[model samples]
Target: MSDQSLLRERWLPGVRELSFGGDYNPEQWPREVWAQDLDLMRRAGVNLVSIGIFSWGLLEPRPGEFDFGWLDEVIEGLHAAGIRVDLGTPTTVPPQWFWQQNPHVRPVMRDGTVLAPGSRGICCPSSPEYAEASLRITTQLAERYGKHPAVALWHVHNEYGAPVSECYCEVSAAAFRAWLQARYGTLDALNTAWGTTFWGQTYGDWSQVGAPAQSASMSNPAHRLDFARFSSDELLGCFTRERDVLHEMSPGVPVTTNFMATNCPSMDLWKWSREVDVVANDHYLTAADPRSQVGLALDADLTRSLADGRPWMLMEHSSSAVNWQPRNLAKRPGELARNSLSHLARGADAILFFQWRASRRGAEKFHSAMLPHAGENSRVFREVTELGATLWSLTDVLSSRVQAPVAILWDWESLWAQDLDWRPSVDLEPRRQVREYYERLWHDKVTVDFAHPTADLSRYAVVLAPASYLLTGEAAANLTAYVEAGGHLVVGPFSGVVDQDDAVHPGGWNGVLRDLLQVSVEEVLPLPENAGVTLTGGTRAGVWAEDLAPQDAETVLEYTDGPAAGRPAVTRRALGGGTATYVSTVLDHHALTAVLDPVLERAGVTIDRDLPWDLEIVSRHGADGSEYVFAINHAGAPVDLPVEGVDLLTGEPCTGSTKIPAGAVRVFRR
Candidate 1:
């Protein structure tokens, strides 16, 4: 076989169907139940399962002592039952023995409280002892099961920055200093970048630097931002360490670590995605939000974009209510299928959950799983099996890519910078801004992909920057070139306010984008709570407003009330071949939709105007020139979708109109 084919074979073995399964923890149950579990998995059309994620303590009960007999039996049973394995290194949870040996490796909080090892993901990323222990376990696992017939993929670790991301321990401090030296090369450059001269906190020696630990007052924003970067890199370094070992021992098998893409703000996925062979993500619905379905779509689209349009994996999601939320809400009837299909609609080749069977005890015992506590006869398990069968039938959609004409700028550094203290308003939430704009477009029936600010925008007809607090000079030049090349750009308020180092642009607000936008912000006006300002277009905005000065741009909507009355609340600048529109205040959803309608029309971006508000439509194109349209109805009543194809879910012919039941999903091959 060719090298590529050999690698594919090693990753997938003989599997030619879409992967369907969840994390299987047979160690939690007795040996008698293992056979029954395999039988049920076969009945559910499960072909792949992640094994040994939290098995560090179980795999090695004592230091250097191994217990692999049970694991070997489980793997043998899975292969005999025609199941593949996504073997995990189990490094996320270190054994108690190892923790006892290296107690100092425990992560320290900013207030100097050393975190105990009762929970998962409690180790410091920069600790050399933890690194050594993790690699030791990883090497043992890879050497044992690297060429195992059932092992298809290597799962390096669990969520990297969940319970703990940054550590204020002394080890982390020294590592942070080293990272700064490599990045800045000298203390002079570091001082200039951090702007430490203002508070008389400039460092003369590298030893004086710390991990932005607890201070008497607020720490420097630049220091905190770089520390966030360093922490993320530290976690990534831990992952690559194990991944390299796996690659060496299991030459052709693919390695990946699940990402909490939208959920975890610590890791920068735009950078992390480049390191993984297959990008996988774990997403859970926020029960508090009534429109969490919109958030789900947003997360799925972002995950797909992180994979660069390649088919990614839904590594973990709840079949019902999750245990961590303040008030866990159970999934309604058909909601499970709807959620899974929504992810599949957005280019997810594999549909998996956190676990196969619900745990009987532990902190996450209450967390929902494929097989709930109520067992296989329950609604959750029935829905899971039904979805599995549906996925099995829709194998043609595997490897298809979701195509989008619009792109949204997603920058983690900008988010981290904006999250710092003492911004214009604490209500200026970056994620909320992006989601509201995404929700508007979702309602407009527009499929969107996320792009880095500095990425090529020529492929997208319309590029939107809903929240870009930190816009670098290179990114600014890229945006200018994209606009000059005839691409429409829409920027939200409070953007271009800072550069990469969390420092304001040289001249004033809206730094590098001022020329391209043809406007400048004289000052930022943060309104009080519950207070709103009016615009000429009958739109009300609150929380944030800018004193905008239009140089050559035409005033689309001028403020009619409040501090900046009569100033341009919204402006449009005609550039070389296209136009750049800027919204100087946070507009309500209705107003945002109204504003984007004309922009969409001018850009020639088509929208499903006749589609129902609760119905979502997205298309994925196969390599063989086939198109699959997924229509998901989140409402409580049936809706008629106009499409010409055969429904893969029911295998029925729909000439033009298909009647989709309430809270149902339909995939049509067009």
Candidate 2:
């Protein structure tokens, strides 16, 4: 299908996310249980099941291993029963034999020490031995099963980022230096890029410039930031090589791997998402903390947006609660359902529960899955079944769904560089400002596509780059072109401070943006914790404010008090057909709208007319150019979104206004 055609599908369309399925281990269960599951699927609408996430031990028990006996039979059984299957590569970790024998699959740290691997993801991307071994094994699997019609999709390396291992080993150190050499070229360039001259630290030779890190040694914030970038690139390299093989071999089947929320630091996601044809990710948050849960949702929307505003899938979610945190907490009754539905509302294509069947024994043995230890009679099972049925019934309506026109850019490097810098104040976090901007934007019924800051901005009418702390020359040029093309731009405070190398650019920080916005920073004001200011009739304040002087820009909002008081807090510059807007202070939800709404409207954009807080709406025109507007309610309370069209899911006649109940969605056609 064409990219535009794929962009128009729904995540759950006709299928229900009965969130009850667990790791389906038909291998462990008898044929009778398989029969029971078939009946169970019919009753609950369990149209899809994920097979073999943490089954490495079973799939590969010995060296040069090959054991798909049980997996093959399990898949055959599911297909025969008419249940779709999402297959796993089972490459989460090498078999003990491979790691033991090759010794090269292990990841290294910055201190140049090698790590022994029995745990998952110990493979080093740069290691020739690892690339050689994995190539043979993965290629073998792809060749065998790439054409299987029974396989809905292949899950590559389940949850690639947990247990946080950074390869600081000698191999990694060598790779890091080489990467640095490529990036900086000389010790003088490296010293300039790292600002090491400040501490009287200058490299004398290539060997003197270690892999900018302190993993097992004294952790340098700046070095850690560089290491994080390198690590993300390394993982991306691994994924790209494997995916190219799959794309060439299994072009018919859609492929995806799950992403953890943005909290993962080992890699930069903006670069990572480019490798996947389809973006897939897992969504979870601490239910006990309201603030935390909300943050996770925003992150998920960003994740879905990474595929250039295309809707994405929720590959894994908790069935009831989880077992891996410092404190294990079960989701409140109905909360899991609520979370799943919210994902659909935000443009998720599928809702997948992590494991189909709970583990009998393992680290995740006690984790919640659809069939509890007692089997299918459990309450979780019933909930799962009901949800599955709900999804199955509405598959056509939800598939091929599309979201809004506005997208947010979430750059991991920008975030890390912002955090690592020795800024004037400790109260401000770059991520905080970005998330707050999104919260308010969502509240306004704006659909956000999250992607690398350098992604094409032309796809969005109004692009938001909240706290783009690290701005590469390439990214700045792209944004410059975007504004010049008449796209509305809203940049948060503290943007354009550093270049791609994590060093301050002498061209007045924001570099090209300073020229585009027609503004230059006189200084960065470090405010006291409670210090704040109001601009444009209301209070607006946050961690720290950028003190800006307009070159040719028009001041929109000004700080209320202090030395920088009465100065401009928000500025706008006209470039080509579009406007470049910069905010000096972070605003609350109410204030953010006051600044952004006008700009979006001036661009002739419409915010989803005052819907409920949890309601998210999106519209799409199919390949035939048939128009569809999706109304999804994510809250427990029923809400009305006034519109005129037929309900695609229910076959109801055109209602003057659509009334969506709690956890329901309405796809309408004119």
The most accurate candidate by TM-score is 1
lDDT of 1 by residue, 233-304 (tens): 999999999988888888778889999989999999999998888889999999999998899999999999
What RMSD does model 2 have?
A: 4.0
Best by lDDT: 1
TM-score of 2: 0.87
lDDT of each: 0.90, 0.70
Q: lDDT for model 1, please.
A: 0.90
Worst 10 residues of 1 by lDDT: 3-12
Query: Compared to the true structure, candidate 1 yields what TM-score?
Result: 0.98
RMSD of each: 1.7, 4.0
Q: lDDT (0-100) at residue 241 of candidate 1?
A: 92
For candidate 2, give the lDDT: 0.70
